[model samples]
Every structure is written in C-alpha cells, then in structure tokens.
Target: MRTLTERRLRLVGVAAQRAHDRLGRYPASAEQILVDYQGTTRSLIAESLVDAWGNPVQLKAGTSFDALSLGADGAPGGEANNADILLSELLASSAPRPRSPEFAGLQRDLADALHLQFQLDGIDYSHAHWRNSDLSVEQIQAALAGKPIPPKRHGPENHGTEPGADVSRADRTDTEKAADALFGALSGDSMLAKAMGFMMKMLGASSQARAMIKIVLADTLVHADAILQAQPAPLAELMKVLTVDRNTQVIHDLRAIIADEPETRSVAVFYGAGHFFDLEKRICSELGYRHESTLWVPAITIDINETGMTAAQLKGFRALMRRTIEQQLKQLD
Candidate 1:
C-alpha cells in the first residue's frame, strides 16, 4: 500500500502542474500552490501536505522544482521508506501539457450550454454563467479589500442587460458571511457536530470520493440549468440559500427601476439558473406577468463518445452521481 508520504508527494506534483498550467509558471512556494489551484468544488488544505511521520514537507524551485518529505527520522537520507521522498522523481514523467483542441471544444460546449434565456412579460432574462475561474487575482484581491470591482463581461452571446442597467442580484460578502456561519455551526464543540465534520473531511479527502464529487458537481451545475428550463423541484434546497433572498432584493430593485425609469419598458434580471424558478414565480404571481416564450441553450454537453467509457460504465457512473447529489441535498436539509 502507498504510504501517506507517497500520496502527499503525488498531490503536490499534481497541484504544481495545475498551477503552472494556469499561471504560466510553477508556484514559488508550497503554500501558494494550493491557493492558486483551488477550485470552486475542491480545496487542498495545507495540513494535508505533511509527511507520514508528521513533518512539514520542504518545497523548493530552482533548475527543477522539488518537494522533499524528509522521512521518519526527519533527517536527510535514510533506508527504505525512511529515505527522503523526492517529488522530482514523480514529476519527471508528469510534466504539464496544454489541453488538446478537442478538450477545449468540449469546455466551450459546456460553457455554451450553461447560458440559458427566458422571455417573460416582453422582457428577456438570461442566466449568466459565472465560475470562480472568471475572477482574476486582482479582482479577488479587490473584493477582499472591500473595493468595488468592475462587472464581469460575459461576452457578446450572454444577451444580458447593459452593464449600468443591470440590477445586482446578490451580495458576495453576505454569501461569504453565511457560509462562514454555516461552517462554524457544523464544526461546533458538540460531539455529534465534530463527528459529522470529521466524516465530511474524510469523504472530501478520499481520492475516489473527490473524483466522484467533481463529476457530481459538474452534473449538478448543468442539471440545475436544465431543471430551471424544465422543472426546478430538485433544486429547491439550493435555490433557498442561493437565490430566494437575493432574488427578492432583485425584485425590489426592479420595482424601483420600473417606477422611476418610465422609459425602460423592458427589463432583464440576469442571474444564475438556480434563481430562475423563484424569479419566475415572483414575476408571474406577484408582478402580474406571464411567460411569453422560453429558449433552451446547451450549457454543457458530456459526449459519451469522446469519454471512451462503455455504456454500462457510463450508466453506473451516472447512477453514482445521482446518489451523491441526493446525499448532499439531504445533508443540506
């Protein structure tokens, strides 16, 4: 069986490669590597990089970058697994490579599918696709500093409202605060809470579980969009936190905009698909509006042909994904 030191070395190599791919250079420090490559759904905790014997791994970059797990003795050289674990050895055959054109096309297809549109009461509303990757380092820093960042340009095909005309739907700061509170509640001093927290960490750290989680999160994001177009019942819990309160604020903004700006005959409230169901209900029932037309845009397409997986395998994978999402939703409840 692979030792903890071996697994951590592999993780460091993978994270370094990913950071290199994104930033055009390898991370200068081990701590920064995790920060740079952190995804919306996955995060690499600093403590996880420690060696099997509970020593901090030393990371350096020179002619070639290397991470050293100074073995059980916490000394330089020793015998067997006690020998220093050189990450360079693992990275030798694992250099970073640019994504293929086919892979880029698949990502574009996925992005295109994520953008959806709806026409209600003679106004066009589009679900804007926003991923954590869309924020630049400068923008993120500015946000942290409490400075207003410029609106993200969603490209010409977004078909959303004009920059100045668009009403803000949600406050990122509020969302962050809510998340902090929830995390604190989950990790409280209570024994049951601690056990639940431990289980969550264990599941998150498992390689198989992490891989399955990535697939499920991807599916949930796309499925959320599709559900918004068809029926959004499955997304009830997600919508409650993500959209309802924020969308209510949006409706209030719309009310003021309509009353103050008489010239504005049509208005668009651009938001994520998770918000659409609630928005639609509010507009039709409260605002005396009705849906005139609907447009379905492909946001993400998982081409089984390109995946090289058998039909049965794909079916089983999808079953696992559904169960994962269901379990997550239950936990949220």
Candidate 2:
C-alpha cells in the first residue's frame, strides 16, 4: 500500500516536471498539474493527482516544484505510514550542466535523463562482460573513466589469441565456436550471407526494431532456461551467469548501500540493456524507485547499400526472419 503511494507520487512529480518543461515554469498547484500537464497517457492525471489514502496531494511551488503527499493520515505530520513524502527528495534531478554548445537538444536530454535515472552520492556500481574475478570494480571504474585498463591478474595475453592456438581452443565453448562460425558466414558471398547482412542493416536502420529484438532475445532466454531444467544449454547457462546472477549481486549491493548510508541521495547502476528489465523491477519494488525516463543510444549501425542487397531482397529477408522468429516463439510456448 505504502509502495503504491510512493510510486504514484513519483509519477505526479514526473508530470510536474513535464509541465515545467512545456510551460517554461512549474505548475502553480497539484490541481494545475492534473489539468495542464501533457503526458504519454490521459489517465495519468487521475492516477497521479491524489495519494493512495484518497487525499488530494499538495503541491509546494517555490523556485523548484515539489509534489507532496501528507501520507496515510492526510495531515501535516505523523509517524510510521503517516510520515510526509516529498517528491523532490525522492527523485534525482541533479544532472551536471552541459559542457559545450554542441550538447544541446537530444544530447542534452540524454545526459539529463541518465543523470536523473541514477543520482549517486555514495557508491556507484558497474558490471562488465568479463567473468574474471580479477576484474575488480575499481578496475571497471578506471576503464570507464578512460584510464588505461590494468592487465588481468592471470592471463591478459591469452585474450584474443588465434582460434587454433592451444589456450584459445581449450577455452572456447561449443556455443562460442558456433557463434564465431555464424559471424564468419556473414562475410561470405552466399545467399544466406547476403540475407543476414540485409537483416543486420534493417536492424541498424530502425531503433524500434533494435529495442524489440532485445525484448525477444530476453524472452527467448527465459523460455530456454525453463525448458532446459537442471541440464541447461551452454548459452542459457552462460546468460544466467552473466545477466541473472550478476544482476542479483548488483541488487544486493544496492540494498546494502541504501541501508548502511541513509544520507546517500542517488545511485547509478551501469549495466547492459538486456539486464535492465529485471533490475528495474527489483529496484522499484524492493528499493522504492519509480521509473521516470529512458534515453536510447544506438550501439551499432550498418549502411544498407554496403550489404549489396536490393530493396526487394531486403524486404523479403526481413519477412522471412520475422516469420522464423514467430514460429520459434510459438514452439517455445
């Protein structure tokens, strides 16, 4: 019940912020927020304008706007569930100023959204793809900060060795070898290669497709894991270790950080996009966070012309892949 109220108040705060952006100033009151705010949905006004206790939320408009909920009591102050909830304090809005004139418009929005997503006052956590125990958090931080990455404790030189090399061959799994072969086939002059290249180009051209692909991949992993049971496939096990287990550890750390450091205002979690759905749910449900915004950045792009496939060829290939994916999903179900 308390969690639901906090989430609703967070949405109200988001609406107020959106109103500020559109109006060139914050709304004068909560009532104004309900009436004047333009959000992604019309029902947001009804859902956000009041607290869970059925009391009208109060808006404290000063130099900065704050959406206030007096809590379950509907009074100024009280204890336990009746304690005041301040939206301003709940949301993280302290983003750094743009460094240059070029950082205007979309770039500025991305920067602000990222800062708003995670405001770190105490400890910040980041996870890298490598499973090496030697790749410490400090090392990851240094690498992210553009410092020279320190050598791995055990086998830095072994990385990226020729596939036929004894160490490399021994280290490579069947799944990794198959992935490498699939990638190798993409450069061939065969019809399948051309089709695959066109599909890659199509994905690069459409951000929505890219996002949907991530969702599909995540869903497939869940189904695969369930089907494999105790004897899971290599890819599913690897994904569980990399995405699921790692996310669990990160959430545990976040929980400890919040509990130990009450003054900590913000927290930044740097993780791959595939891992976000579960992590976001855990944070919002367990740690009392509410989703406000998202900033999308393309990781890969390919020119369609470079693929040497005609428009018709591309369209046919895309449809084929879509049908194949749908069939596979149905089989999984």
Candidate 3:
C-alpha cells in the first residue's frame, strides 16, 4: 500500500488532471470537501477507502453515490455518521445497534424498495440520485402509488440551476423527517432534519428540508484513530465495496429507473471524489460525465507512508470537518 505521503501526491495528480479535463484550467483553492461516505449506501469497500486516496478523486460526477447509513442501530440519527465508515477493521464486523430483527425487516424492505425502485426506473438510483434528484419528488409519489414515473432528468446543469443555491434542505417537510429518521440515523442536525422531512412527506405529510449552516466539532487524527482501535470489528467488507467498480450495477439501476419513471428522470448523486477513476480503461471514460471547479484546490504532496488516521484522529478529523463549518460561520465579520 502507498504511504500517506505518496497518497497525498497521487491525490494532487488526480485533482490536477480532473481540473484540466473539466474546466481546461487549474484549481485556485487548496482545500478539499471532506465528505464522501456520508448519506450513501456502501458495501464496505467504499467506507474504508474514504479519502484514503492519495489525492482528491473527482470533484463532481454525472452519477454519484450519496446516501446515509443509519446510526448504530442501522437507523439515521444525529451525532452519527450517515456512512458506515470506521478508521479500522474492528468496527466493521461488530453488529450495528439497530441490527435488531424487527428493524432489519423494515431495513431490508427499504433496501428492497430502493433496489427495486432503481431497477424499475432503469437508472442510477444511488441514494444520492434519489435524494438529490428532482426525480425523487415524483419517485416518492410514484413509489407510493406503485405507478410508472416519467423519464429521469438529465444532469442538474442541463436544468440551468444556480450553483450553490440549487439544493435547499428546507424543501423537505417535518413528516418527511420522521420517515427519513425511521429509515436511517442521519447525523448532523441538518441531515437528520432534512431526511426526516423528506421521508415524512413521501410517507404522507412531510416537513421541509432544513439547512443549518453550522457543524460544531473539533478533533485531531490521533483521537480518531483511537476510536477505531477501540472498536473491534473487521471492516474489510466495507472497504472492499468502496474500491470496486460499481458503475455497471449503477448503470443497470439507472436503466431500471428510466424504464419505470420515464417522465421525472431528474436525479443527482453526490459522493467522494475518489469513486471516479481516470485510470486508463476505467469507468469514468465509459460514463460520460464532466468535472467542473475541481482545479481550484491545490494538492498536498507528501511521501507515501502508512495511513495517518488513527481512531481518535479519524473521529477528530470528522469532528474537525464538522467544527470547521462552525468556525467559518463564526468568522462572518
């Protein structure tokens, strides 16, 4: 395996190439958005491989895998990660909190619902697609009604939406929030609230999606690694899922979505940049997606060493990622 330093350098290269391809320009910023595993379903591989890339994977994608893993109970909750990623293997094998037989049925049902929904639509139904897509609106209704939907929407840009303001959490309603919370434990006030609202609406009367600007946290890698070390489940399964090429499955699902919902085909998925591999003969070439605004971030080059994230550190980093958001908010001078 490459050392953390080498990985950083590689990450730099990936970012550079992606930037060139997307904007035909270079990045103007050095900071990378730290979210990858949150709000997305993963097999195991994707979780362990989060940000493990030496460089930023890809800034954007036409199809993304954004979904939230329910909290320890396998249900959504605040103060818990939406993705099942842990710093080490131990936590992986350990049973999740809600792995209860009762909830498992519903969980499986939802998964089945999601799987079949995607299969029916004949399109990429990564949770991100469902949550982010305009198709999701119709998807909820159609899924409830057991009726066919219209065509999926093209990539968001084709719709001509303003960049930052495009997605607002407030769109979800309160009932949706409960349903979403019922589905999975979405940490972070905003994520939990948003999921709850949307779910409520879909199930019946949902609340509007909420966007809370502050993520209060401050952690270092050391602390993160410790937390991982203490948890004793092998996370190999999750890791394997992340590294594998899932586009074919994604494609199959996307096609299914299209077949079922031909009218409201609009969907969007957001996930870690690493999923898009520029490697020769990789999925990216096969999947015609473009990257924009990838170039602005500068790559951090370092010699390859072992991964630097300890349990405490990983937690700390996550905390930092969250807290940093708060810091920025505090800086509104």
Candidate 4:
C-alpha cells in the first residue's frame, strides 16, 4: 500500500502534467496547477497544500514541472524518511533531462590534483555525488538572455557599503583608491562586463562570488596579462573555493546523519575529488571515524598530450591559470 505522502506526490505529478498538457507549458506556481488541473476551488488556500511532514511543497517550472517535498526533517537532502520526494520521479516520462554541458576535463584534472582516494577502513561506504538543482535547456537559455540575473535566495543583502565602496576617501593612498576605482568600473555596462555577468549566471554562480571574479578578471586580463603568462597555476585557489566551499552543506548533511542515526553503518560520501580531503578530515577528526580503504573509479578518461594543442600553447594555458589563482589569493589576503 502507498503511504499518504507517496500518494500525495503521485497526485501532484498527475496535476502538474495535466496543467502542462492544458497550458502547453508548466504552471509557474503550485497553486496554478492545483486550481487549473486538479479542480481545486480558487478560494482554496495555497499554504494548506503541504506534504505529510507539514512542509509546503516547492515547485519549479521548466520544460516540465518539479514538485519537491523536503521530507520528514524538512531539510534540503536526506536519506530514508527524510529523503526528498520529487513529483517528477513519480512521472518520469513527463520529466525532461537537463542539457548542461559535462565538465569532464575539469573534473578529471581536479581529481588528479586532489589525489582523490576512495577507501574508508572498517566501514562499508556507498558513493553519491552532490549536484546542483536540475535546470532544463529552456531555463539555461532564459538565463543567458542577458537580463539581470536575479539575486540568490537567502543571499546577503546589499547595504551599499560593499567592498571598494570607500575608494575615494582622502585617507586612502592614491594607488589604493585607483585599485578600488578599477574594481568599481569593472561592474559597469561595458560589453566585456556584460558578457562576464551572463556567463556567471549561466553557471549558477553566487552574486557575491561572481562580483569578485569580475574584479579579478578585470585586474588580471586587462592590465597584467603578461604576468599571468609567466605563472603556471593561475586560478587554482578560486577553483578550490568554487569547487569545495560550494559543497559545505553536503558535509553538514553527512555529519547530521551519522549523529542522528547510530545504526547508519557503512556510510558512503561520494562527492567530487576536490571535496574528499576536507570531508575526510571532518569525518575522522570530528566524527571519530577512520580511513579504511578506497576504490578508484575513472569518471572521465583524457590525455592532454593527445589533444592537438602545441606544447607552447599548453604551457601558456597553465601559466595563465596560475596567474589567475594568484590574483584570487591576493583578494583573500
């Protein structure tokens, strides 16, 4: 027999598909689907439509609809009863796959650099990768339409006192003020700036981090290209933050599971190679776990030497990346 929650998820999937069939597009809001397709009275309160866990379901519209219940704990991701319930999973035929380009090369390189090991001693581990929310091809295209990207939900508020805002103060050195001015100007309406902004949004970058990347790009690409040409590990630090910090929540979730359920033997944290080092430290030192064993799985296979690029070209690319990394580190300092 289907549980009440499972039955509700089935109903949501049916209603979402019906709304899509009628309107030729997914409804923008859950209430719209409920009213138009499920025959719910317009006077029905939207908030009343919640899962068995009493959390309001989240709805996202794309080429198809996604209705999500955060599950028993009402958090983003979990296992067992707390695992997310997705309406699209119930109606897999009506769901569309995301069309984002695979970052196989980047993944491979980062994996090697991090020296990712797959073993944990005395524990049976399962593997799972952390991923961003699904976005359809249509959603990606819409985001790249050059419109101002919406600020991230739950992101920090802008109070006008953001970094570089005090560039013109008399107490500041001329060079310091000039640097600040340059950073500010990079955020202007120039074509290059606009293009950078668009690309950042397409990658689902946070607004604050995107702004920093723009400043670094402006400072390095515009003025110090030769210096970057001399470096071999450009952008390494920035890449670390982009790849590692973004998955902090995954670590938190793992810790929560271990703490809450003592019987959760043989836990598997299958994340990107970049994430394993920090996660290992947390798991062992903080959680009283020890490294046991690892299994190496090739996520991608590639040989840089096989690529048609000349030796000089490859060296130059590495140098440029190094310089980019150095500049990002400076900003942190």
RMSD of each: 21.5, 14.2, 23.7, 19.8
The models' CA-based lDDT, in order, is 0.55, 0.57, 0.35, 0.50
Higher-ranked by TM-score: 1 or 3: 1
Tens digits of per-residue lDDT for model 3 on 1-333?
223323333444344345454565544333322222122222222332224322222223222212122223343344533233221222235343332232233333333322222122223435432543233343333322324544554554243223443233665444343434444542213565456445533532211111011111113322332332342222222222322323333554545566688886454444433333422224245445344223234222221122244556545756667566455435532
Q: What is the lDDT of residue 260 in candidate 2?
A: 97
Clashes of each: 4, 3, 125, 18
- Residue 51 lDDT in candidate 3: 40
lDDT of the structure predicted as candidate 1: 0.55
What TM-scores do the predictions have?
A: 0.34, 0.35, 0.20, 0.28
Instruction: Compose the digit string of candidate 1's lDDT tens values, residues 121-167.
Output: 12222335222223333333234334665444344333333345322
lDDT-better candidate, 1 vs 2? 2
lDDT of 4: 0.50
TM-score of 2: 0.35
The alpha-carbon deviation from the true structure for residue 196 of candidate 3, after best TM-score superposition, in angstroms, is 25
Candidate 4 ranges with C-alpha deviation above 4 Å: 1-96, 99-194, 197-256, 270-274, 294-307, 310-333
- Per-residue error (Å), model 4, residue 82: 33
Q: Which ten residues in a row have the lowest lDDT in candidate 4?
A: 114-123
